[model samples]
Target chain A: MAEVDEASKPLLRDLKAVGKKFGHVMYPKKSTTLLRDWDLWGPLLLCVTLALMLQGGSADSKEDGGPQFAEVFVIIWFGSVIITLNSKLLGGTISFFQSLCVLGYCILPLTVAMIVCRLVLLGGTGTASFIVRFIVVVASFGWSTFASTAFLADSQPPNRKALVVYPVFLFYFVISWMIVTFSPSHSDGTTDTGP
Target chain B: MSTTERNKNPNSTESWGGFEDNPIQGGGSAVIDMENMDDTSGSSFEDMGDMHQRIKEEEEVSEEAAATEEGDDGEFLGMKGVKGQLGRQVADEVWQAGKRQASKAFNLYGNIDILRPYFDVEPIQVRNRLLESLIPVRIINFPQKIAGELYGPLMLVFTLVAILLHGMKTSGTVIREGTLMGTAIGTCFGYWLGISSFIYFLAYLCNAQITMLQILSLLGYGLFGHCVVLFVTYTVHFHSLFYILWLVVGGLSTLRMVAALISRTVGHTPRLILCATLSALHMLFLLYLHFAYHKIVEGILDTLEGPNVPPFQRIARDIPEVSVALVNTTVKTISATLQSY
Candidate 1:
């Protein structure tokens, strides 16, 4: 009985860690959660899921076009890596992963939008579905940009806040494009912002 | 963290939250020990030092728990990453040298010791895993990694590619071989891995917990449907056939992919979401197949139309002659029936 109790402790600890991270994501009012004891697990997961959802024409050969998970995976990771480099080069105060954590975790709203879009698409995907999807994606795009910049704004050097925010905007915009154009060939969860 | 999961059965996918942990936590077996965790690993930064200390600590805890004798020996053999990294190279070499002998003495299966981790209650069924993966009928049963096979999907993919290449060659399509191979392999494998990873991501989203390989096996089998579409183009060659085939293959695979995922889904909305997504995947795959290879039907017709002979004339030449008496008797019977009417 004692051994069984001891065996299960690690599992309980892991649950607590995930719950705490989720709390921080749900309420982006603090940076200490992601800033101080940074771990890539949350970011990596959100990145993979978002990449999978946004899988578009990037992976296809020239003729039979569509994005591959590899392309989305590379784009998201490399995109963030480049942004991290830019921030650090400009003498940002935060570590690379902390800034990355901010960018990655803020994608939660967009990810949820993807899920909702997928569900809305279940009814039909004509002009109406496109409109619904556009609103949701626009809202998510706004939310992601705002949240990431909110967290990362302090990390930038005083004069170069635009420089940091600009790249962050581009990064999220690229992700949003992937989300908007996603057709769910596996039935994408997000809606088409345009026809 | 993943080491335990690597040993863990698919049954444990329900609570996948703890997966993707700090990879530092190997030798997960010795984690059962409660005491001496601090004294051994307190100074060391490496996870191996923690495991080595935990294994030593297990000896004291063994008096009460008494089940981890094999767990200690299996660590050296399993966590190969730790091979040369430990502080004492000479002692590590000695430990390496004794691994096989140690495994034989302590593990349940002796030399076949890797099996100890999986500890199956039911027998390993390779045939079931293979057949089910192709059609995805028995989804309630979690796919056992030990029993999973890639040969079926791999072969079907190869055959479909080969058939498409052959069709293009015979039809005088002038695409370069390199480009053809690149496109075929890319679409085949890209779509396979892409869609599987997508479903995996979806399952993760809905908390439907599944192993990566299980999802791979489930989606890999859809290649069989692609092969079916290609095979029918030969004898019954027609450009319009794909429309009907899409309905048949897409609907069936949708049902199968959904049923397979059913056992793992968390609830109603997820079920509906998965059903829509899976059916949509099937629809896309069928359409992709048609785009890539529907020309094969026309190609087959082109081959059959050899040198001024339409297919009807060529086939007509193959018919054996009919007797005049038989023709006359059939005409007389038809005339009598018309008179009676």
Candidate 2:
């Protein structure tokens, strides 16, 4: 074997090599990067902590005859802000506060659309109900997806952004509808009306 | 004579590189002499056959000894055992048993595709094989620190959004008799299929290392149970709400799996923010809808059914034409029905 230069060989090269070997197993390039950072973890931790706290608070509120809605909303707002700040700081294309603001923008429009769909389009057996539902779900979810992508992107990967947004929005649309249709009537169960 | 030539010609027992230094057989008489000197060695052709048999038996005994020694150290079976006819027979029996058990467990849901890979190996080998396979995956592919750190929060946020949205959709209405049943079934299948496909898709992208047989096996497991649920739901015309719910939940689960699989560069803060905010907004809007509609519907029902019904009934009866009277009666009846609930 020929003698090799010691200095020319980078110390970090071995780590990089190990990472490359691992890259084969992990699949998807994005996941590889996520494994390397500390800042990225902060928002995630915050989001989870807030979610649990909110859930517990809501449950307790219902038990204590306090309002559940406001508490839940506050938790959501808190989580969104933390996530937004984290994304911005972590080098997301989008700004820290913009993502959170987008949520506010989407809230009213989506609510109106859902209400309109239910009031004007639903009731009595017909294809109208189905069409309305499909429209509502697609429109709301589609817009929500766009908003999320825009909120997070400095410049998205063309259509890749939609992958995250569309499916999630549609999922929310359906789940929301299902919960409404199936959960016990507010009066019968804990329908916290307290302010 | 030079040391090399002297060793090569005479004793025949002195091989090049001491026989152990060079793993490959270097041509030398030392090996031949050792074989020739052994008591089992013979001159006749029949004796040669017996010598070969003895050699084979000795190798087998050594292998068994190795296995025993290694087994204590947690090396279950060697590659030779796995590749042997006995291993294949055991694998076949385990596979059959897995299929039967899976089928029974998912009685209504037939043809679940996601879980097939898990059941393909013999029951005995399943855990060992799975563990073996996971070792490389864990070391090479699974970004455990990252995935574990991110996944918990991601799941928690996702669950919250799901719950909130569900709350909004069905808040004030009469609990539809079968909607829950339908939603539960739908969610189960939807998540199962979504996760299964995502895994398959990831496997496809990752070097094509996973065999087609493996992918199909997993798909088979995933789809089998889910399909049964689909069949039951469609056949019985169970609640559409449930079906819709299932599709969404399944899609979400699948989406997450894909994201994780493709995570070559998960941009930390930005991704987290986007995920969290979007989820929160989705939940908030849904909850709003749930409360508003629920209250309105309940109010409408109450107005018709409580206190004001007798007056409406009298008015309905007094209407001149039967059509008008019927319409009035129906309106009052529906209003009452909703309000009373």
Candidate 3:
């Protein structure tokens, strides 16, 4: 027992020394600290931004306004969020604003395609002859999602990565609101509103 | 090393008779006469003959070894000078084995040496090429981002299950309606959410090679087809076969998309996500749209007919029927056209 105790004393001292080294590395001296440390402030800023987004209200309010317009908005917003997350996940090589720009640019072709679908499927022009427009809406929406994911997002500029991101998401939200507010309301022509 | 040297007379002891004639050779007296010593019992004329036989056996064994060594050396040298070196080397080793067998036959004085030449035929080149081609077509440097083959069939099965559940829910089977409906909703949402998340990950995090425009365009085409079918059938009272035909078109288009995805530089994870999302969103949107539209038309129908109106006085009755029929027909047609699964 005495011999074993003698062997363990050096080991105990070595462990204590290692612990002190670790503590010293972890603790900062005045000279080692920086004024503009992102580690200290970055997350705080992100949280504040996120709070702002949440405060913009539920993303589902376009249901009564226009499902098609709402859908396009959702697609764009979702894509922007993805871009933002992606940038953050990649150590902020991409920014929220850049993702927004990418999102906006991406939605352009999809919107055009959707408009074409609308013209093709619902081109009839009389009040009594309102064409069935769902096909164009759904097709455009689905295509927009696919095109944005596959093409525009892939082609986003690497340098201005995050700068274009947040704006794109906001654009999606705004466009969706516009689509809801402006789409031809079926309510105008119909008297029955209940189940 | 030759067999002939081994067969040379062992009786050449005449040159070494001085050593042979030593008293040790006769051994008449027990020199080391330890009590109960048994040398006389262990030695005899039979033992002498046995010793001769053992020596002969050892010489035969050594001769065989020497022959094999020579055989191997010849095989190696023969292989060195040959074209198609690898094939020749293999053939030479086999030839060495054959030569060994032939040598053994010569040693044994046997007649089994006649058939060795027939085994020397080279393999046919066409046969070899065919054998090579039989190897599986391996996709080299396959991206490990996702196990594509596994995920594809899995997604397909999930979609089928969802479709089955949706069918059951709409089939008016009451007792299991709740379960079917739950499963239908769950499957649709699960597939959509999962695919959407993966797409998000691929676009943002993985920096996928695909563009959003391409994806959206494909989906838009499908939706446009869907809407057209709905409108045509609902408004024009087209037969259900037109819808079926449209569905066939949708299927073919989807297959084309899949082929395109595979041929392009699209990664497996993104492609898989694309497929899953397209399927889920298409199903969810179509189902909801159809049911909701039906309910809207029903409300319109109820309001068009006042409570005390006689059958003859229903001016808008036919219009409601025509409108509902048009919507239903168009829905079915477009839904069929959009069918990828």
Candidate 4:
């Protein structure tokens, strides 16, 4: 009982410290605090929100063969894990969870772009709507890539930084491609595939 | 002394002393004297008189001090009473403080000289900054205060002129249909104010410490891009390239300004989200104008003519077949696996 009590005291203190760190992450600045004391809840919450956005976009899509909910969640989870592993293999100083956190939060812009593209599709499928969706997806893709790189890029070795960034770039590009291609499912089984 | 002797003597002070000396013999007269006396005793009455005199002197001194105080400060001269003066002074101080805050809110509009390059020259640097602002990064030193102020008014004038010109081009007459011109101008201004106010509300929700003037100025500068488009269209042919260029410039400038303003308050995630949403709205506005004002209807007809590929799709279609097949295969496999669940 005494040993457990002694252990619980330090654990409680550590939890309190982590709680404060989480507060800082909620209103993140260009500071190192988020990277210093990484937490799971922040990234998990963000991933769930991203998943919800993906699901919402799919639900509104005109195509019948869009990715399901589980597919999106799996893709995001596996994508983050793959990127984190790649980042580690490249001798990046950041840990697996920290990389995951950064990558997951970075998905925010693309998720927002997806929701917006879906909404724009609702108005009409004119060339103007396509242009609007294109601009949004491109801008958000760039933003997501930039935001993630701002945190993860510095952790990489100086010489191999470009190599590390390639994966990150490709990661966001794939997501943007998916968002751009997503369309609402029709009542019939036929899908309206974009060129 | 007897009561009658005291009354007849007419020397009341000496008689009172005599009565006090022979208390037993003049007991009845002393009782009557006590009854006629004032409620207060002699020593107490003297003390009360001294206190009243001191209080009157203090009042006069305070009045002099207040008058001198009011003289020292010219702002309180109009007030008649001391209380009125003090009250007015407090109110004046509050009013001055409020004025200082109001001035701070409008401080961006003060120095117009910094924007001289925009008017006198091409303002290449400012234009470059406008493009750079779209990057959603922290800019340590933006010459937004002065340049933005000048941009707002200039943009407003350009917008008005553009609307008038568009009216002239469309209706074939400006002076004949005065009400139409007036309505168009009113609609333009109303839309400008409405969109600016909406952006301000979004900034507020983000807890960004941005002033209304800053937002209005940024949006005004954005309108300057549209004015360029209008001028080009009016003078030359309505080319899609120029229209697209306007969209790029205006959209980027507005996006950069918004991102810069809210970068400090919101995190990177929310900031990018807001930027995307706002930029999307800007594109929608451009599309609306393209259809409403230009009446080109090319995009609409494209949509109607078979299953037309969107511009984005056309660009996507240019990618190598291998990468496209790879992405499709990966997505299909993953989705196929998840379908069982």
Candidate 5:
């Protein structure tokens, strides 16, 4: 009984520490402790939820069809891998897991944007819908790109920054394109959708 | 005889009648004699050797007298000497204690070290890191420092300046209209104070160890993005792209600060809720500003010159659809040519 009690004390302390780590994500300042002692749980959870959200938002669209859950996952996973590899090839020193963590967390703004898009779609379609969708996509893309680069940019050799940033730009452009083209089909079938 | 001469010569006590023989009278006369002896000190140096011998004998006699006095009233004599020393020591202690208390109070205002990053961080880096929401360690450490008291006031000053600049840019008549300027300032301060206090109260209820000043500073820091936006708008005139860029950058900056605060105090779920709530409030505040501007202008002009649409709504009109169309066409051309195969 005494041994069990002693074991549980450290366990409780660890649990508390984990909780604190999760909270630190919201902090504006980068916590070196968090960077040093990274975990996969939070990033994994966020990626899943974000993918689900993006899928759910596009699910109702008949034109160009919504992305499947697996497709969303593949896009994020593959994109992260490509970006991570590209950075490493360019003499960047960030570990694979750390790169993945940064990339995954960067999806948060896009996730929020998608959720907002979903709500906006519920209101109507046409110029207003396109406008809101366009703004949200652009904003989220900018945010994700900026966020990812902020973490990854410093790792690359100074002379090769543009080379490293090019892939990031393309990555965000593709995401933005997907978001912009995500048009929910109207039952009325008015094909003349104003740009 | 002077008290010093009397103290030097052991026989002087016998001539003057010993303090033991008449303690009250002897004590009174001893004080009087000491006062008179102050003027005769130069003349007394002539018999220094003789006086030294007498002083040694007097010390022996006084030591014996003190020993006897200890038996009769030792506690009283000891206490008298102690009281004199204790008064000086107590006063010294009290002065030191007050200084410590004042320093503790002054610390609530904030520390200069927290502002170091703002100066040390390169401008380009600030723009990049701020937009990405990747806050540096120093920026994070700023709020955690005990010296965060200055954050609120600094934020206020920056925000007020931004608002004034925004007013100048938006309205030609604003510079001349005292009432308008006053109203704008009042509204800005009122909103900031109200929102900061509300958040502070909510944080308090959540059992977070955040101070009112910290919350105020956080909110104030969030406005910095807007300050930049206003500056750009004032200088360059309105450009949709620049506006959106600044908006995102500002939003991220604010979000980062709020996240930092929430992470320290609340649980994960509560932190998310609080963050979302704060973000929504910020969006709402922006919306309110848009409408409020129109109302103020309409009231002043008595007729709306143009529809005061939210700047975000202009995004649709401003979007470069031509580029999007070209991209779409290129994709279609490639896909269709491949399908022909």
Candidate 6:
């Protein structure tokens, strides 16, 4: 009776904290406390969501997409790690996971864009649907880039800021591009969508 | 925090085995850890013998509680060994412990036993020292994060549950009883819902005006070929009959759909493309089922060795099996090094 702090209790707290952090990413202002201490919880949650959506939002699949999931998972994590290491090597003030936190958290806008793109994609492989998805992806891609750089750029030295932002730019660009270009695989050989 | 409570629950602290009745451990070592007090009294370690005795007791407790709970790091006594600030060894030890505890709490077993490699297999979240990973992120460390009710775990659970139903069955009626009935019921609704929705979406894309009910009833009849194929393949089994039936049934389904399109007078070119595409989609689904569960439909169940590989086992085969011996040796060395007890 003396101890109310049980396992389930902190989990709730942590989730609340995670939710709060997500809010911080949503409205990115000089939130370096976010930079000082960050958890991969939000980032990972976003990563998993993006990965599944990329593979077709269908829960039941007939494809062996082990490689595809692994492909997305590895690219995101490794890209962030390399970006983080590069920042650290350049004497950026941020720690490894703080950089990871910003890099991963900023993926939020892109993730949303991917969801919208996937749903719009369901409207079929026509020019109208394709144009709608393009605008959404481009808008969110810009938002993601702006938000991530806005959060990350201040941490770098004035001259080296471009160096840091470049990778971050590439990182978001690659993911957004993936969302843009992805097409569901058709089984029949001659059934390719004609240009 | 749960960290303190959990740490104490696994108090499997044998050094204090004799001191179980001591006032410090009397309250089941709940939130207020008496060990934290002992750890703070850092200056006085009553020499090597006392530490050895505590270490020996801890190992025994670890073995006992390991079958149930995961971490006893909350009962961790490494604090008494280090005096003021953390030593280099203690720092690394603390980092390693934090990583291990975090992984266990998240249900993430990395590297050697990469069970749920890419995504979180389990949806439950336990707040432990998990947020703080002190180890250097060297070249993509093992998959370590998963949360609940999301698509990664949700789809994984649904697909795994559907497949495991096949895994548990070992009998003479592997196909007829095990897969065929499941396939029939599943394809009846799933395939119907799937194709109709697909066609409706495709119609919208192609600027064809067709009502949902019209498409649904059309596609419902279109499923007759697949239903017939299911029963025919059920009774008479042939190796090539599967693919051969794929062409025939797929064509029939397409023809029925095209005939419905002709009556409706939607358009000319779109009808031809729609029928051909539907045929291709049907072929795709049949090819997937055949290739996915290859051996189960080989006509006579008596001739085959046993049940065919389950869908997930086929997915599992995609992961190159790591040798058990290598895993053991690496695990042994890691445990031996991390055994600060």
Q: lDDT by residue for model 6 over B1-341, one digit each (tens)?
A: 33333356453232333432334333344322334433332333445566456445544444444434434653343343233224656887999999989988656312313322222222222111111111112222232221221212222222322222221111111332333324433644576567778888877766655666556545544444544454344334344575578777756565545654544435667756665666677667655544444323221222233323332223323111233343567799999989965
After superposing candidate 5 on the true structure, give the runs of residues whose Cα lies further than 4 Å from its correct spot.
A1-34, A57-64, A186-195, B1-341
lDDT of 4 by residue, B62-85 (tens): 344445453434223222223554
2 against 3, candidate with superior lDDT = 3
lDDT of 2 by residue, B1-341 (tens): 12232244443222222322222332332233233332222333434454455444434444444444434332222223234535667888999999988888666223333332222222233223322221223232443212111212232233434443333322322223333223433443344345445544644444333443433333223232223233233222223433453455433432342333234324455435433432343333333322222222232344334422211111112112543454588899999999999
* lDDT of the structure predicted as candidate 1: 0.56
**DockQ of each model vs. true complex:** 0.01, 0.02, 0.03, 0.01, 0.01, 0.01
Computed on alpha carbons, the lDDT of every model, listed in order, comes to 0.56, 0.36, 0.37, 0.54, 0.53, 0.53
TM-score of each: 0.35, 0.26, 0.24, 0.32, 0.32, 0.36
TM-score between candidate 3 chain A and the true chain A: 0.33
Name the lDDT of candidate 6: 0.53
Specify the highest-DockQ model's number: 3
TM-score for chain B of all predictions: 0.46, 0.21, 0.26, 0.41, 0.41, 0.34
lDDT of 2 by residue, A1-195 (tens): 223556546645644643443332223222322223212222333333333332342253232222234433553465465444334323335433445544333333344444544454336323354455456645655554454444444333443333234333533344233322211112222222211
Q: Kindly give the stretch of ten consecutive residues in candidate 1 chain A with the minimal lDDT sum.
A: A186-195
What TM-score does chain A reach in every model? 0.83, 0.40, 0.33, 0.74, 0.75, 0.84
Number of the top-ranking candidate, with lDDT as the measure: 1
Candidate 3 RMSD to the real structure: 27.8
* Model 6 chain B poorest 10 in a row by lDDT: B126-135
TM for candidate 5 is 0.32
Query: Residue B96 error for model 2, in Å?
Result: 68
Instruction: Show the colliding residue pairs in model 4.
Output: A60-A184, A61-A183, A61-A184, A61-A185, A62-A183, A62-A184, A62-A185, A63-A184, B133-B256
Which of 2 and 3 is ahead in TM-score? 2
Q: Which regions of candidate 6 fall more than 4 Å away from where they truly are?
A: A1-7, A57-67, A185-195, B1-341
Docking class of 5: incorrect
What TM value does chain A in model 4 reach?
A: 0.74
